[model samples]
Target: DIDVLASSEDAEKVMDHFSTLPTVVDVTGKGHTKTSVRLKGGIAVDLRVVSPEQYPYALHHFTGSKEHNTKMRHIAKSMGLKMNEYGLFSDEGNENIPCSSEEDLFKALGMTYIPPELREDMGEIEAALENKLPKLVESKDMLGIFHFHSHYSDGSNSIAELAEEVKRQGYRYMGMADHSRSAYYARGLKEEDILRQIEEIDELNSKYKDFHIFKGIESDILTDGSLDYSNDFLKNLDFVIASVHSQFRMDKESMTKRISTAMDNPHTTMLGHITGRLLLSRDGYEVDLDKILGKAAQKGTVLEINANPHRLDLDWRWVKKAKEMGIRIMINPDAHSLSEIAYTSFGIAMARKGWCEKKDVLNCLDIDAIKKFLHN
Candidate 1:
């Protein structure tokens, strides 16, 4: 459900206006404190009348993960205060304490302001109490974007077109990882094709002083746990993203072994979307993430948080665990179109939800540092 904010005076007007929109199919609970509406595509939305005086408290309560809100309420109770969306109140006389902002609401509870992304109740409250919450990674921290595809491999744009567009969008570098030869459906690249692309990249690099395009491929991990290309061939690329595009039904143990073996390859720079889940369409293959996470930690394998909305794999929870293990996260939009490159914002959201700091993300690396990292 989507939460919409409106003042008491404007709440009814907002709902009436919203109900009249062409996209809205039905409305319910009209003229009440809250109204629910069904959009054309079956999406549900709620418009809540959070009065101006209590707006901060309403936002804090409504946006927080249920567990986080519960923990906050428990803390308030311990302090002899009652807390709700309206405001924090004294238990004795129901006297409301005023809060001008979410930060003030947090301060009243003797805690530091918690960012919305980190409000998962997974140690955030405790960290806030100790004034030790991490400064989460933001979209501005990224200097480049990875996992782009061009027309050479099932993508909509050509290399030159994609490069010019990505450069104009303000990133210093654009890393392209088209499919390797094994993905016939995508017309994945052959060795000669990769060689040709490298030469093209070199020519493109000569045109601009501030930008560089990294030659890379999304190598398929075969059933036997080997990458699509030979190590000699793979080493030619600036980076490699090893992913599983087929064979999603292996038992947990075999799947785990398959990914673990790939992670051990020094040429395998990053492991893409640890689970092959397609959001609402399909379940991820059975794989032991514990083993995969441990393997990545041991070998310093970069775990990719695929930023495609359908696959936010290497899910935020796992991203957090990997971060704690000193694993580096590369949030790739897995973009197949120019518009999809902007999906980096979604990846940053997932990374922030995972409690990632600037240092925890690979995209935050400077050009020199990233080049060194790619070589390693």
Candidate 2:
């Protein structure tokens, strides 16, 4: 959903402007507080006009998880303040409290400002009230990322190209987790291909003093719950991301057990897209998430918050739960192309929304720290 906010005076202009767009099929509520523009493809873009003083209030109000906003209003009420999308007011005199930004609004309430990502009412309010909100991991905190592909698999770019792009983006390291031989549909790399890719990565690392690429692969977990490659081959790689690429219909207990067994592998470094979900397309496989988290916690296995918009697996809710269980989280773009590498931004948002701190994310570490983390 495309949501936008405009000033009250420019409401008509804003509404009229978008209505004339070539993609717009219909427009309604032309001169009202809100206008809905129906695009040719059936997506509705809603625009709401508010006063400058109301922007901050309206922004959060409109971005509601409903539960979070309601809780905020309740807190305001307890303080004898009237809170609404228009503005916060004193109940005694109905005087509007001035707020130029969201932070100001929170400060006025005597609470720490909460990021939009954490505005889901998932303990954020309570944490904010006590000034105990997590210092959520930000985009700048990511020093590197994992689970991106290369030409060795189905990716559009070569390993060197991807590594150079990652370095250009200011990352210290990146992990090349191409599809394993089992994922033949994705041009998965075979044993020989992996060997060559490892050699290439080694060569690249030697040439570039500023960057390093971890030799990694997204190994498939067979239905029997074993990883795709032998321990010897898997050990040769710097990291291995175990994932369920097929058999989404496996029952909860079986699927959970399957993933658990893979994590049990000594060479497994991380679990990719724990749910095997393709957002807006297919439901994730049935798995006991608590059990999976428990296994990961027991083994110190890192979890992937697949940053692909279509599959934000290791979902925000689970990301937070995983952190609480002392599990490390890695925001992998799961990108198959160069442009998609930026998808890590979305993963960072999800991670923050899940209350992740820099310390909780593996990529936030520097070269030495990451090397140490991976080696362990």
Candidate 3:
């Protein structure tokens, strides 16, 4: 469990209470002013101190539901507070207090009480007008994107073209997860083809300065829970994104075994599109998502929010479960063409619906961090 603190007194009170719980493991105070608290049972809490004057803005920033925060922002715009993740902004451009308190911030925002979970835009906007609005996520605080596809396998453009597009959109980086060898329907690359693609990516990196390419493969997790390539080949990749392709029909146990096999692979950095469910076009293949998501979190693997309009697999509901378990996520447009590269925006929007933030997203990493994560 996580807790947010507002002051030294608050921290002391928490520490005193935590001392009584036999299961508590550790307590760490982080953030500016050491306002955070960690519980012993692997539960962490952060405490913030917001001045009474800045309470509204602080509460708005911390109490987040992307949709709710969005609605609250509309209220702030009317009231003249330019709210964000860090703090509320005044039109005069003064030094920000970065208020750390939640309740005080809410009071400042002039809103009635609303919990974080209830912040979705359902009716929060109307509520805020009467001094109530659910807190939401802000677009500016978002770092970047994680998974995407290009012409390397079934993608439409070369690695260089994809990088250029992501850069144009102001993203820090994009993961080049082209299809694996078994996806013959999408022109999946064989071992030699994979090596050749790696070389081309190297050449592109030499030519491009602003963006970097990650040597990743969207490898197929075969029906029997085996990857399409040898271990030697999988290790050569910067990251391996394992996914299920053909044989959508199977029992729950079989599907679980298939995914378990892939997770067992040390090279598998992510489990692609968990549910295999397509939003409107195709009903997703059935699987034990709770089990799969739990395993993924334990193994340090991400679940892809396949951003393809047709295949928004790993529905937003599961995303919530992943968030609770601290499971990492990667949202990709599964771009097959240059035009489709912009689909990251669509994916990001969907992630917001699941209450995902940059910290929860793997694609938010820069090239170096990504390299370390994959290699280590």
Best by TM-score: 1
Better of 1 and 3 by TM-score: 1
Determine which window of 10 residues in candidate 1 has minimal summed lDDT: 6-15
* TM-scores for candidates 1 onward, in order: 0.98, 0.96, 0.65
Against the true structure, candidate 1 has what lDDT? 0.90
In Å, residue 308's CA in model 3 sits off its true spot by 1.3
User: Model 3, 1-376: lDDT tens per residue?
Assistant: 4535343324444446544456545545434333444455455655565444554554555666677778777776787777775566775674454545555456566766655555666554466548644233344544455455666566667777777777777776666777777788888888898788789878987876766777888888998888888888787788888888888988888998899889999889888877787765677776888888878878888788788777776776777678779998877778877778667666666666666767777777766776677788
Name the lDDT of candidate 2. 0.89
TM-score, ranked from best to worst: 1, 2, 3
lDDT of 1 at 228: 90
Which portions of model 3 show Cα errors greater than 4 Å?
A: 1-146
How much does candidate 3 score in TM-score?
Answer: 0.65
- Candidate 2 stretches greater than 4 Å from native: none
- Candidate 1 per-residue lDDT, tens place, 1-376, comes to 6778766666777677877899889986676677889888988888888678988999888889999999999999999999999999999999999999999999999999999888889999999999999999987889888898899889999888888888898888889999989999999999998899899999999998998899899999998889998998887889889999999999999999998888878799999988988899999999999888888888989999899999998899999999999999999999999889878888899999999999999999888889999997
